[model samples]
Target: MKNILRTAGVLAVASASVLTGVTAAQAAPSCSTARVCLYDDYWFTGTPRSFGWVTYNVGVDSNDKGSSLVIGPATDPASPYVYFYVDNNFAGNNVVFRAGNASNDLRGLYMTPTRNWDDEITSVWG
Candidate 1:
């Protein structure tokens, strides 16, 4: 009886642990922490590109091509955020996103007072 009880307790703990791990995995973004991930399509679908802490021009694989994005916590959590620019070299109109934020699409994001961000991102600061 003792052996059976101990085994049941162990199995219960193991099952709980496994379920917790699955929930965490499902909640996590596809990209790593401290990086910004850009998606080619809405709802984080399509090709993905990740950027670390730096200001860079979006090039071949992702230039003026981002339709959605996920911003993860920065290396320093307190300063977690990224900026998307309308023109290269981080110039022109821009929009900001804080850590852990994801946009399904850019079609409704304001790049400037006069422009939308969808498919017009030329640079980024992460």
Candidate 2:
């Protein structure tokens, strides 16, 4: 799902066949290259769940719960965007982020006119 997007702070989204969830209270991981990491809270704090290429549902533990995001360089330069969705099965409103981007706070990125990307993501892909 595509919506009106904000240009500042350079936010990120998600997608992956392989995703890793870290403890929410734990500090964020390095995030590495060719990966997208979604944080439980703003400023890359709290829990962090990282992902690679392919689509994902974000699981029950992390669905609609992301507050920030970090993206690594794309493995495939031709497909360098990460996608975050508002609905399951890769449906509903969505945000697409470029590789190597990071957002300290997803709250500032608009997913819809009145709603921001923070805590509104249900699915993801790159």
Candidate 3:
């Protein structure tokens, strides 16, 4: 009985550790080089949206639906940052996201009364 209990305890600890690790990994964001990724929810959770090289007026689908984003290292040396706007047609409050800098959560960067930009982005460019 004593040996059996010890084995069960070890298995329980191992399982807990594995679960914890998975949760931590899911809470972080991973960005690919030369691309921009936006997460619908903070801490890199929820829907993942990607963008490429272009001057864009974020379409209706992704409009006002970004909570956090990742700006990968600029593959083009001349363009080292991405500019985002709070309104359509690149109008309203704007923010710059430099290459090699990003966040898992937007609450620190973009915020509202509730969740950071829960659904309030309109345009982007790099």
Which lDDT tens digits does candidate 3 get at residues 6-96?
A: 9998888778768876444554465777777888887676788887634456677788888777887788878898887778666787778
lDDT of each: 0.76, 0.75, 0.72
Candidate 2 per-residue lDDT, tens place, 2-115, comes to 443542212322212124332333333457777778888887878888766564687888888889888888888898888888998789888888887777788899976899
Question: Which candidate would rank higher by lDDT, 2 or 3?
Answer: 2
Candidate of highest lDDT: 1
RMSD of 1: 6.6
Error of 2 at 41 (Å): 0.6
Assess every candidate by TM-score. Answer: 0.70, 0.72, 0.66
Where does candidate 1 clash, by residue pair? none
Task: List candidate 2 stretches off by more than 4 Å.
Answer: 1-29
Best by TM-score: 2
Q: State how far residue 49 of model 1 sits from its true place (Å).
A: 1.4
Of the two candidates 1 and 2, the one with more favorable lDDT, higher being better, is: 1
- Residue 55 miss distance in model 1 (angstroms): 3.4
